[model samples]
Target chain A: MKLSREEVVHIAALARMSMSEAEIEKAREQLANILENFAVLKEVDTTNVSPTTQSIKLQSVMRNDIPGESLPAEKILANAPDREGDLFKLRPVLE
Target chain B: MTDKYTDLTIHSAHELLKAKKISSVELTKHYLDRIKKVEPQVRAIVTVTEDSALQQAKQADEAIANGKATPLTGIPVLIKDVMCTKDIKTTCSSKMLENFVPPYNATAVEKLNNAGAVMVGKANMDEFAMGSSTENSAFFTTHNPWDLSRVPGGSSGGSAAGVAASEAIYALGSDTGGSIRQPAGFCNVTGLKPTYGRVSRYGLVAFASSLDQIGPLTKDALDSALVMNVISGYDSRDSTSAPEAVPDYTKGLTKNLKGMKIGIPKEYFVEGMQAEVETAIKDAIRKLEELGAKVEWGVSLPHTRHALAVYYIIAPSEASANLARYDGSKYGFSYKDTDSMWEGMEKTKQLGFGPEVKRRIMLGTYALSSGYYDAYYLKAQKVRTLIRREFDQAFEKYDALVTPTSPTVPFKIGEKADNPLQMYLSDICTLPINIAGIPAISIPAGFAKDLPIGMQIIGKPFAEKTIFKISYAYQQVTDWHKKTAKL
Candidate 1:
């Protein structure tokens, strides 16, 4: 339950967030406290109890494979931070 | 600007509209003028669609003239910023999505639009619906109307506060734990968190997909039921939406509770619960009994204590995944001064998200990380099943369960802000119902030292009718729901 400073950094990296040294230290303490609170769950014996991912048990809610109208390319790209002629532009991933 | 229409409920407004006593344009203008007057102190609204609302109101008036008006026609409603409304900024009170305007309306919003409801504004909420108080809103904190120094409980704080302050007749809020009900309790309004899948979540910004639900906050239970009639239905876009037929929720508002077995779960009366809250809830229970409800105390939900822990783990884990889409890519806040996409994403999230949001993301990241997933995430889900089973067993014997919606009355704005654990505990009495995915409502029970206290009535899955019936029957005899804040 005790989250070390290094562990906090790792988690933040995985979460794609950067933090100041003070925030990291604070997060370390706060996250550790929250995790400690969660430790109480270990006492509950849930053997053979299936996890309930969703409350409603619905079978595949499939729609017919018919073509439907789509948002225009301009509207689709309207909110993109960087776009070029209706296509979203991202920084080079392979470079 | 007439001050008279500001205090009228959705029901009263509908009657007036039908009788031609007031036009929708006149009613909408009255609320808009009131919003202009009270919004400065309450800070309940994040965006006020004045021009569009008036236009919608004019159309509603035209519809009324043509005899095409529905129940919600011409009524003004505040929407929680989490539910998308086409072209209106759905901020979720997070700077990450502060400028993001959704191109599509959420199914709930679309339904309201179809029913001719006027969009008053988007109500403020905790950043990404992460906090129990509006203090976590990146833009500004919403003050409680009852006591300006106190917080309207959140993340649906603005919706509840808006209704309490008469800024709107009713509002829509998404409850991912105690968001709607807790705020309603704090503001002395009625809010319902429908059973999961009862309402479509198609364009609602997800916090924890499994736990989140869209519901109504109104002046009273009857208004909540009417709004539910418009918003609750199946949608093909939402895979989790139940295929069950939608019912007329307003039909369940009959003030008849004779022979209804109501359970009083003993575990909900915890150590830290405020004495005033306990007394108010006990008094409400007595009133229910007098109204012909058979009250049974000491119904045990032994797994209730683990609900908060389970919620923190599961909800944060889901939120972490859901929020990952907020990187500087398609919409929302973006950091451009970076060498690579990864750095830009990191900077965007770090700068955009608030402290509580960051804390949750980190906690969720850690919990769902490779080595820890089995120990934390899976275990929490298993415990969730146990919690749901407890509710099922209780509902098998009792028609509904009653408890205090929150452990305490509305705290001072900064009282528990420093301690996240303490703030999280504000939701202790309400979280278990969400864990079970059952419909529950917080109705004004009474006032404790001028601040309002809420009594929650919980029902089995997809049993909104039963909960609505109990709440309406209780409201029939109580004057608490009728009392308006002086502000």
Candidate 2:
């Protein structure tokens, strides 16, 4: 699975990042090398093997749904780049 | 009297504070003054909270007057910038969050505050905790307190350097892979990464949620224990936080480990390991043996050969998901206001995230995306299970495992920045512990050609107490923990 320059651009676009032509070329080469390196895993036999998510030996530890304390408006607005009376104003999401 | 206790431990600080010999205000002011003098060269702090610290110290004084002070009450502590602090600029050393302050404090920060620790400042880190050296910080690089020409190791570089320089009593650092311990090794301090879920991650801006663990970076094992006791516990806000019994870690400080067996994994002493590091580790094992502990070589962690690969796959995959929320709209470093929201996000992330971060995110998103999930992401997870099984079997025989915290001493800044694979290999010995979800500590073992090396002590899940006992006992017999960087 060699990553082409076009594929790298697609990933960047999906990830919401802009890359220059030079960066795209660099990323393509790097990604290709890494994919080649990691391809060794294809040699491993994972048949009848289950993927492990949590490393610790525990089950049934999920917490009940509960609300936590919210920071006051003063702290909330403390470092906002643009605030309009208790709201964090942004360029409107739609349009 | 002042000269005698300049390199004071956390225990000594508390005693002096109780006796009214030194107020927290004076202690904070002293370090604050030292930081002002040395920080230009050291570059350890991203922001110094002089005003809030004085105010916190005043509150500590009032608590002391009322005889209601906790062990860490009035203690000045530095936090890694990655952890969000309410009302304080919490830049994770990236332009994206340079002007961003969190509306909420991280559970760890809030817990530390509730335990009465005063915020000294936010320590500089690799951008979004992405790199292994502080050079990646958009703000400034933190120099090693031991040697200015070298780096302090990152993304917890600033925290480690602060402790090593005597600029702060102790500090808190986050470790995903080797962030906390590597810097601690480089700066000649003690760092403990508690078992994942041992500490809450509510306000920790996620890097790789599965691998990231918030822990203590301190001057000694005692301070690490003190800080851990305050920060470790269950928090409903963090669904992943472990609901285990929080023990009094300080109570086991002097517990004897006379017959406790320590395992030294043969795999860790590979060919590429520096000769100086090998010598230092052997000397450390000998010192522990002299303290009535039995040392034995064990054949364990055979899957460690693939640990780095597994980590690279899993960590970036998770990081891609975690970092996706930082679009230009809700975060800092937005592009031109005229740009559309999506356009601004693309432009902002392009300008804001470092090369390494963007690289990881791309790799991760690719791994988890529609077509390739089984080949990369799923395969890595299966290997991760094997890695954990190896540790489980090894711990069944040995009370604890010991290894070099890093294969080599800290390299110069920008030395490996250009080579991604070289940078990734730095976490070889430390990454497996995170994969296995066990508690591990990196303490100053000895120095190699004047550069410090760390001996990593690893234990079973929730066995931090055992790890500390061995570390504390070893320190009691050796002066390595007491040796300060010759800055």
Candidate 3:
């Protein structure tokens, strides 16, 4: 349950977040405390219990694989922070 | 006459609009005026759609005059900013989406619009519906109408406070854990969290997908029922939306509970619960007993103690995944200071999210990380099954269960802002219902030191009607729901 600074940084990287040293220290302490509270779950005996991903039981819904009308390029790009022509503009992925 | 329009519930407003006693435009204007007057003190609204509301209200009047009106026609409604509103900003009280307006409406918003309901404005909430108190809002915290210094329990605090202050007749909010119910309890309004899959989630912004549900916050239980009728139904757009038929929820509003069995779980009365909250809930139970319903005590939900721990794990894990959509390149706030896209993505998230959101995302990432996944995420899911089974057993012996909606009345802002665990504990009474995917409602039972107390009625899956029946009956006898904030 004790989260080290290294672990916090690794988790942040995985989550695609850049945290300052103060935030990392704060997260290290807070996440450790939260996980410590979750330690009680270890006491429950779930030898054969199945994991519940969804609360309500339902079969995956299927739909026709046909092409359908989609949002116009203009509408889809309306909220994009950076756009070029009809495509989302981003800093080069590889340099 | 203006006061009369401001005081009208959705049900009453519908009648007045139909009888030609009030026009939709007039009713919408009265609420807009109320919002203008009270919003400075309450801070419940994020964006007031004055122009669009009046235009919609004029359209509703035309529909009513043309004799083609629905039950919700001409009724002004406040929407939780988490739901998509076409051409209107849906911020979720986060800087990430501060100026992000959707091009299409959420299924719930579409349904309400089809019912002729006017969108008054978007109510404020915690960023991404992450916190128990509105303090987590990136913009500002919502004040409880009853006590301006106290927080309206959130992340649906704005929706609850709006209804209590007559800023809106009824508001829609999404509940993940106790977002809707706790705030409704704090603000002395009736809030319902319909069974998961009973309502469509197509347009709702996902926080913890499995646990989230959109419901109503209203002046009373009957208003909740009326709103439910308009909003609940299966939609092909939401894969998780149940295929089962949505009944006429209003038909369950009768003030009768003969032969009903209500269970009181012993685990809910924890050590730190406010003495006043305990007393109000017990008094409400006695009232139910006097109304010919049987009350059973000592019902054991042994897994209840572990629900909080389970929720913190599962909810954050889902949130981390759901929130991954907010990277800089697409929509929302982007960080352009960095030349590399990867650095920009990271910087955007760092700048966009607040403390609580980052904390949750970190916790979720750590739990779902390679080696830790089995120990944290898998273990929590297995315990979740146990929690659901405990409710299943309790429901077998009782028609519904009753508990104090919150362990205490609304607390002052900043009292528990620094302490995350304590804030999470505020939702102790309501989280189990969400984990079980059952329907539950928080109705005003009484007041504690001038602040409202809510008693929760929980029912089996898709049993909103049963909870409505019990809640409506309780409202018929008590004046709690009739009291309004002096603001």
Candidate 4:
């Protein structure tokens, strides 16, 4: 279950993480070992079994649509690393 | 350590306050002074909120004078840094959100606040709640109070260690896996993980959405119960918060193990576990029988062996999705060196997250990727169903189950840091309870060579009282819970 270096690179890309060659190699070996453990799950017969997404019963939580007090804009924006007036400032995605 | 206020439990401290022997400010000063002295050795706290804690202690004293005191009134406590504390730094012991201060309080914190519980500071945790040991913490490793060279099990290591070291009466910690219970085991304290949806997850930072729940790390079973009474209730803020009535957790906890059907799951006593841990847990189970519990052996949970694999899939898959919010956009750390926003997001994550966090994200992304989804993620989820069904079926026949909280005593700090799979296996005994969404308590059973051993009592869903009662019964008969680790 050795993941190719290319597979590791592809995953890092998908996760928006950049890893050096050494890091990718290490991740490849480790992830493969963890996944190897999952080989046991493949043997279980789950033909009609439904996947459990939530551990408890599901329900729709309702709330009134009426406007209520909320955190002020300044407070909501307090933790932003970079901000402009009332909006977040970000690096350019397209120039 | 010889001071009167240093090792006070919440119940005893409350009585002293009620009798006017000590004001909340005096008690707090003693604890604050204690923290100043011991924190250099234990390193369990991340941010010490001295000014605000004393302010809250002052208010607590005023409330006590008016005879409007609750059980937690004037009690000093610690909140795990994973929970949001308005205006206080809520770092998950990671650089990613090292300075992230939320504008709100976690529902559990709010409950403690209403009860006049004084929050002294934020406790440390594994970065993003990712590691089994506190070595993964970015700031510093929290030393086991019993043996400073060994790790206090994590990611709730700091909270458990704080209580064991007599730094605080108790602390609030979040458990997605074995985070709460394992650390409590390592530190010789009582830790409870309530049934899923029992406590609100509104302001706690999400790791694995389905698995995360907040609970108390305290001195003994009774203190854990008292804290549970305050924090366990419905909240409209979290959609998953249960509407179930929270019973008076401190009441009806008699040594009535008579005819209380208990199952000792055979799968839990896996091969290669520390022999000392096995002997201690078995001795605790026998003591339960002596007190009249109808203990049964060889109960099978065949799916138990696969629990760790199922958890790794479900947890990290959910984590990869939950953590997508940190993209150098709305809050926390941002990378400014890159002009390309996409590259900036990548660099931000790379620089901000620790190794374990990135490893989990990669494991999750690889599992959910197009070709592997059905084979890994979907299959794991289905097996999760099988595991839950086993627990539910077993509970139908037994009132509760008993197992070792952790497979071994606390290991040396650097023992398993580099090996991810080995670290993950440390939680094998405790993960299935989270997977099945049941309640479990880890109470100090005995010690192995001076390090503490913990016995886990697990109950059916929303049956926290039953588990707490059993743990309380055990505490009544044994002095293990009464012993404190020497700092």
Candidate 5:
């Protein structure tokens, strides 16, 4: 169950985390060790069993579409690392 | 010269407050002074809100003067750093959120605030509530109050340690998989992880959204029950919040355990578990029998063996999705000096999160990735359904389940630091309850060479009152919980 360097790199890309070569090697080793334990799940007989997304039964929650009280705009934006007049300013996504 | 307030329980403290024997401000100041003296060794609190605590205490004093006081009025309490406290820095002990402050209180915090509870400070935790040991915290590891070299089991390590060290009367802790109960066991305190949906998760930072829950860590079962009465209820803010009618938990919490049926699951007593811990739990079970509760052993939960695997898969998968919010674009740390937006996002995650966080995100991404979903994520969910069914059937035959809270007493800080799987094994005793979405409490049962041991009581969903009654009755006869850390 040793994850390859390429597989770890792919997961890091999918997770949007950049790792150095040393970190990737370490992650490959650790994640492989963790996944090896997961191999035990293959022994269970799960025929016709449904997946549980959550433990409790959930229903479609429909509430009235109305705004009662919201956080003040200034306060909500106060923690923004880079804000430009109530807008979160970020680097350009495209050229 | 010594502070008497540090040793007062919520029941006694409430009587004193009502009789005007001690003003709220005086009690609050006593704890703050105690924190100043003892906090150096424990390192439990991340941020001490001194000014806000004094103001809240003054307001509570005025309310008492007006002859209007509630159970928690003017009580000094600590909050887990994962919960947002409006205007107070809520660091999850990570560099990514070291300065992040919310504009609104978490529903639990709001409830405590509304009840006039003074905010002593925010307790530290594992980074993003990810690890079994608080050593994963970016700032510092919370030491077990009993032995400073040992770890206070975590991710709620600081909360449990603070209560054990008498830094705070009680504290709030979140449990996804045994976070609260394990720490409470190590620190010699009572910790309850309420049934999922019993408490609102709004303003509490999400980690494995489906599995995460909030509860109280306190000195005694009565104090834990009183705090549960305040924080457990429905809220529209969290979608998963239950709509069940809230019951007064302390109403029938008497020392009467007559006619209660308790079952002991045989699967939890696996090999490699410490001999002392097993003896302590067995002694506590005998005590329950003495108190009139029928203790049934050899109760079976066949699927218990697979809980650890299912939890690792499901929790990380949910965590990967829940933590996608921390891209550093909104309110947390942002790394923008990179070449492009994509690079900035990647670099923010790279530099902000610690090694364990990255490992989990990687693990989650791998599990949910194409071609592997069916084998890992989907299969785990199906097994989760089976695990939940076993608990449902077991409850049909018993009122509650009894087991050891942790496999062993507190270990040295660096004992399992290098091995992730070994650390995960530490949570084996408490993980099945969370997978089944049931409520459980870890009450101090006995000690092993001065290190405390806790026996866990598992009840059916929304059955906090039953477990509290059993623990209260058990503590009434045994003085194990009254023993405090000699810090």
Candidate 6:
């Protein structure tokens, strides 16, 4: 697959990262090389091999719903860069 | 105090505490003093819990006084900033979460605290564990303890450097691909990436959920075992956690392996490996041979060449899905000057994530997105199965596989920062195990040109005990693991 500068920008936007022109160029080249390297996977002939998701074969170990104590609010906000009354305060999201 | 305490392993420190030769508070103070003296140069810590550490040490001393203490009692430990610690700034080395603190402890932190392990502080790491070097940390990059000019290795670089410099008796590091082993190699400490399900992932911040495993970065193999025993077990909170019984990992420490077979895959000795690394690994093999283990040149992992490629696809895909949670509304770090919700999220994410992290999230989103899933993500899973099958076939005849952890020793900071491919290739020898979901460890094999070299011992699935035994045996026979950098 050919990766373009615009695609790189699109991906960056999707990933929620702002990039400079230089980073866009660098990401394009790096992703290209990685894509080319990963092209080797296309060569391996897997006619009937089942795709494995989890390495272990176990399944369905769900637990019953249970209540747990929440940590104290003071402890939660101890490291906050900015905190308000019982909540983590931040810059206004909308102008 | 200078020489002995600086390189003391968790095992030795625990022995001294048990024998009443040293007090837990004295040991904690010794490490705290060391961190105070050396952390300025290393930059390994983010938030230090000095008061809490001393209080914890006092409690440990009281426990021992009351005749009840575990093997890890009184040992000081450093956690990667990614793990949540109550009231402690668990930054994950990112500015977005720079002021973020958890209200409760991660299960691992709680377990370690209950075991009487003193929490030194949170160690610096790659922001969200996104990069190979701690250079990507939003706070600061960790310098190698051996050579201050170079990177220690990351996103677990802080933990690696901490243990290497004895800033902490032992440190816990999370490995996605080669985070644990790569830094351990560079810092010349022992690092273990336990089997995927063997260690609980409850408290560890998400990087690549399928690949991340929390393990120990320590001075020697025995301490790795001790830490592993305490950390590994079934956690009801983590669905992927293994339900298997946690064995007394230190039980096989003195077991002899006169005829055990060790495999040496020729693919690992590929062209890009540096001469010094090759020499150190060869020397380690010879030493292992002399110790009565039968060494054989084995060739089974033909798909090993595709490991790095497969890892890039698989890890990014998982990371893309895992990182979707940090959208500025529900979690830490949000930029909110924009008009729309989408714009707000974009502003927050763009401002929060670093370049390396952004690049990965993009790649992962692209791989897992529409029309490309079958070609990239699904194909990668199929290839993953083949990789596991290859290891299974190889381990049938051989007890374990041996190789160098990293191609070269610690590289200078910003050395490969521009060249991402060169940085990615560092995981060439270590990525296969994570793909196959097996346990592998990096121990100090020897040194080349003043820097340390790491020897990787790859074991079968759920057979971490075997790797521990081999590494412990190697440490007994060689003094390489005992060498300390005069920082």
Sort every candidate by DockQ, greatest first. 5, 3, 1, 4, 2, 6
Give candidate 4 misplaced runs (Cα > 4 Å): none
Instruction: Please name the candidate that would achieve the greatest DockQ relative to the true structure.
Output: 5
Task: List model 2 lDDT by residue over B61-170, tens digit each.
Answer: 88988899888999888999999887788899988888887887899999988877888899999988887778889988899977788888888999999888877888
lDDT by residue for model 5 over B55-116, one digit each (tens)?
Answer: 99999999999988998999999999999999999989999999898999999999999999
lDDT, candidates in the order shown: 0.92, 0.86, 0.92, 0.91, 0.91, 0.86
**Candidate 2 clashes between residue pairs 3 or more apart in a chain or in different chains:** none
Q: Taking the tens digit of each residue's C-alpha lDDT, what string does model 4 give over B269-322?
A: 988799999999999999999888999999999999989989999899999888
Which model is ahead, 1 or 2, in terms of lDDT? 1
Off by over 4 Å in 5: B1-3
Write one digit per residue (lDDT tens) for candidate 1, span B1-487.
2357656888999999999999999898989999999999999999999999999999999999999999999999999999998888889998888888788899999999999999999999999998998999999999999999999999999999999999999999989999999999999999999999999999999999999999999988888889988898888889999878888888846667898999999999999899999999999999999988999999998999999999999999999999999888888889999778788999999999999999889888889999999999999999999999989989889999999999899999999999999999999988988888889999999998899999999998888889989999988888999888887
Clashing pairs in 5: none
TM-score of 4: 0.99
What DockQ values do the models have?
A: 0.82, 0.59, 0.85, 0.82, 0.86, 0.47
Task: For candidate 5, report its TM-score.
Answer: 0.99
The list of candidate 1 runs beyond 4 A from truth reads none
lDDT of 5 at B41: 91
- Per-residue lDDT, model 1, residue B242, is 87
Model with the higher TM-score, candidate 3 or 6? 3
Quickly count the clashes in candidate 3.
0
* Proportion of native contacts kept per candidate: 0.84, 0.55, 0.85, 0.82, 0.87, 0.51
TM-score, candidate number 1: 0.98
The deviation in Å at residue A80 for candidate 4 is 1.1
